[model samples]
Target: MYRIGEFSKICRVPVSALRYYSDLGLLPPESIDPESGYRYYSAGQLPRLNRILALKDLGLSLEEISAILDEDLPAGELRGMLRLKRAEIGQRVSEEQARLARVENRLRMIESEDRMPDQEIVLKELEDVPVVSIREVLSNPQDVGMLIADGYSALMPAGIMPIGACFSIYHDPEFDPTALDVEIAYPVAETVTDVPDTPGGRSFERRVVRGGRAAVTIHQGPYDMIDQVYTRIGKWISDHELQIAGEPQEAYLTAPDDPGGPVTEIRFPVA
Candidate 1:
């Protein structure tokens, strides 16, 4: 048997930590004095202390480590827990990587142009895709979200996940401030036979968006500034001697409520 101080020296863990672990019922001393309240630990307890420290270094919370140690958890259960931790860390790393890329791109843009361009348009060939969509004549532009949500909600029951970003296809040749003809669509991997009805009793149908050549540009910031991006697209199409062959599309690349900045891809079909 070793006194608490001696045990702490041998295990290389502080007395406070040992006390904390003991208070949590993780590792208790071999015995405690009845009158003076001194604690004695056995050399055998060193192995348990080592395991706790090892798990702590692996980022496990004290509570989790306590449960794992107290229950003498099975190897499979421990592996499962570690797997979940790994996945969570991996997701964080991926998000950081994307942020890093954006930072690097911004640096390059500033160095080359003295400032970032308002909008950079490029031609891209969009491929045909299967989509579940809702066609609506929205009373105002603000109602776009309602239609998008309705389209997604109606399709969610089919258990099919969207393959890409949610996009809207404008059907009207010219713009109307109060009335808009829009088809909101979410691309899905597989087509569903059964159609679902929106909250307003409109049928959500599965259709293939045709493949075509279009000019695409990413708009960063609020939706209110999106019209400027469309202006650039129109100028680029005319410079290339191309005419607008079909309606414009806007694909949302980030959450609408993102505080940093929301990314929107504006595309116009050209021939």
Candidate 2:
């Protein structure tokens, strides 16, 4: 048996924490002297203390940890809870990484603002193109690639092949990266009827992407840096006194496996 301070040293936990746990009935000492009120913990209680510390590290609340310890929760249920916490942490890390990338990109752009080259902006009339497409609201912009890949996989089995580049139409009136309203499409020579939906539940439909006079420019780098091109286009539109008439679209010109990122043509309908 070891006194409270000695046990604290052995377990590498604070004596105050041990006392608090005892008060909460989480890790009570094995014995206590009634006259002098000294708490002693036996080596047998070490396993229980370790379990409490492990659960706390897994992000569980004190109340939740107490319930799990007191009720002797099943191992399977505890494993499931740990898995859920892991996924939550993973999602937060992904979001933070993306946010950090954006911050770094912005800083770089600001530093090079003066020496930025003028991107060529073309104004031309586009003809109507028929396509097979799926429109969905995505919670994360990163998922757009998977959605496009899934669309192609679904179409290939139906003998539908794209005659031209795959493209995406931004349907939202205002840009919202977190909840993007996008339409992924593949241009077909002719519209086919009754195409089955993707296995992921996105319904495929045949539609004509309306065309009009548009301002277009090509972006040839990471998608995260595409915003720089968009900024130039917006300035060009303003300088030319043109008003945007519809949602923008991006046509991918390179294969998905391109190591340097896809070369994309961005178009904005204008009046």
Candidate 3:
């Protein structure tokens, strides 16, 4: 039998961690000295300690590891748990990759701070509006205009009265030019029940566009150059130490196909 300190050295685990495991009934010592209150572990417990360390390296919590070890789980159950852990790790890796990309993008924004647009950005409370929306996945951003037109045409036939400019809600966690998930919606005053088929062969559903504190900005020009506006707003939000509270909305203020000009107002909810 080895004392707790000696056992810790053998297992390459910290003395405090061993005591914690013992306290949690995960790796109790084989015997405890009644007089001195010392903890002693047997060589046989080394395998269990190794298992705990291995699972910890896989990002399993102590409580989960304790349950897994204490239950003497079957081989199939153990394999399934490991598989789930593997998938979770994969998802974490993807999230970290995205985070790294965002950090790099922020760095680029800082480098280009000199050329940032001087567009007027304002904070305002946008009132809630009811909308009939058609959500679809697009292979490219250029399809947004056609999809919005189709939505309007479908809604017009259904006698849906539009109150204001049509807007779109970006659903993708990050902006992707190659593939996008967006909801094109038109504000309506009257409650309508008919779900009209969009030009893209999708059904429109009624939903409320939540309103709150929003950082609003206008971009006048083509839609292709809108990324610059987005980058500017994102930088402004960060500069003010504000948190994005909800999804972004882009209200089209001009005709989508008009060569004259298409002005767009971008609103990002902030807290």
Off by over 4 Å in 3: 1-117, 257-260
Q: lDDT tens digits, residues 1-271, model 1?
A: 9887888899888989888877877898889899988888999988888888899887788889998988889999999999998998889898798568656766876999898776777779999988888888888998998888877776777576788999999998888867899999888876455666866788877889997998889888878977778777787677656799888999988876778788888999998
All predictions: root-mean-square deviation over Cα?
12.5, 17.7, 12.0
Find the number of clashing residue pairs for candidate 2. 0
Q: Across residues 144-196, which tens digit of lDDT does each residue of candidate 2 receive?
A: 89989999999899898889999999999888988999999899877477688
Question: What clash pairs does model 3 have?
Answer: none
Error of 1 at 204 (Å): 0.8
Candidates' C-alpha lDDT: 0.84, 0.88, 0.87
Pick by TM-score: 1 or 2, better one: 2
Q: What is the lDDT of residue 170 in candidate 2?
A: 95
Candidate 2 Cα outliers beyond 4 Å, as residue runs: 1-118
Better of 1 and 2 by lDDT: 2
Error of 3 at 165 (Å): 0.4
The lowest-lDDT stretch of 10 consecutive residues in candidate 2 is 101-110
Candidate 1 segments whose C-alpha is farther than 4 A from its true place: 1-116, 257-259
lDDT, candidate 3, 109-201, per-residue tens:
668884544586777999888888988888988899889889888888777878899999999889887889999989987566667787667
